[model samples]
Target: MRFKLQTDYALRALVYMAAKQGENCTTDEIAGYFQISAAHLGRVIRRLQNHGYVKAIRGRRGGVRLDRDPESVNLGEVVEVLEEGAQPLDPPTGEPGNGVDDALRLKAVLRRAHGLFVNYLNKVTLAELVAEGLPEPQPAQQPSEESAPAEPQPTVAAEPEVASSPEKTPEPVGAPSAAPGYGRPGSPTYGGY
Candidate 1:
């Protein structure tokens, strides 16, 4: 299911703050980095501030900082808070039968699916989201001036190492080859493709 733009912005801002390690950041800074409108981000920040997830400071050298620990911020809870009153499927109305029952059943299934989705999100925390270091900012490249050519260094060729058994190489016991957050090979959740 798709989330509202404001919900998406709120999550992005939180992730940025989490990666910043408690450093205060301005809305303009975040908006500029994300290439979004500062005014829209400001509204999202205000909502976050009202929810006590972010604290806004006033005056000089003022900015917003995360008010709570990253570990305490559950992704599901954040989504729920930011998406309050948002209905994924409209409630079925009118008398029973005549396709109304089918709509009601579909709504129920959607509700259950949404609950499962949120449950999965609950397993993830803000800290986990930012456990990896932030991406390095790219600097603008400058044009190089024409200069004298330099000689290239000499290269050495090496033979590739060969396994003792050509048919198959032995893998370490209990070693995980799959990426994190994904099911292991042979598991039900594993996407073999």
Candidate 2:
């Protein structure tokens, strides 16, 4: 269920462009804003351009501008395109029919959950993401780990709470893993993740 950082960068870049309207956003600009790599963001920008989300301008004023309206771009569709790098699930294997039925059931559940996720995203547009304006405070030019001077550590806070939407209800917790002779420390057949 994890998404790569490239997806995060792509969405951020799009939001920046969507907010800018006519301004062309450069990879360097986005990279500096998000404290990410410009080269990596450039590759993401290329993929986005190929998918018709943006058009890249070359030369002195080289940058990317939104090709389609923000409202016209569905988040789900964009996520599908960006998730091309996700590894496909390997088919059920080993132990002839030992867990084929269970595996198939699990696969079906995974597929259904994934479909619901994407379908939910489909209802939202890029416009909604930028409606509240860009996030702040604008980050300073980030110093590299080695060159940056160390500062006093701040007290860590508890995990932030998230507001749940009325449109969705939480699923019940599932049973714990039933791997035989596993989970317990120093178990004979324990396999660490």
lDDT top scorer: 1
Candidate 2 per-residue C-alpha lDDT over 132-151 given as tens digits, one digit per residue, 9 for 90 to 100: 55543233233353256668
Per-candidate local distance difference test: 0.73, 0.70
Q: Rate residue 79 of model 1 by lDDT.
A: 90
Task: Give the runs in model 1 whose Cα sits over 4 Å from its true position.
Answer: 135-193
Tell me the TM-score of each prediction against the true structure.
0.68, 0.66
TM-score of 1: 0.68
lDDT of 2 at 86: 51
RMSD of each: 13.4, 14.8
Off by over 4 Å in 2: 85-88, 95-97, 136-193
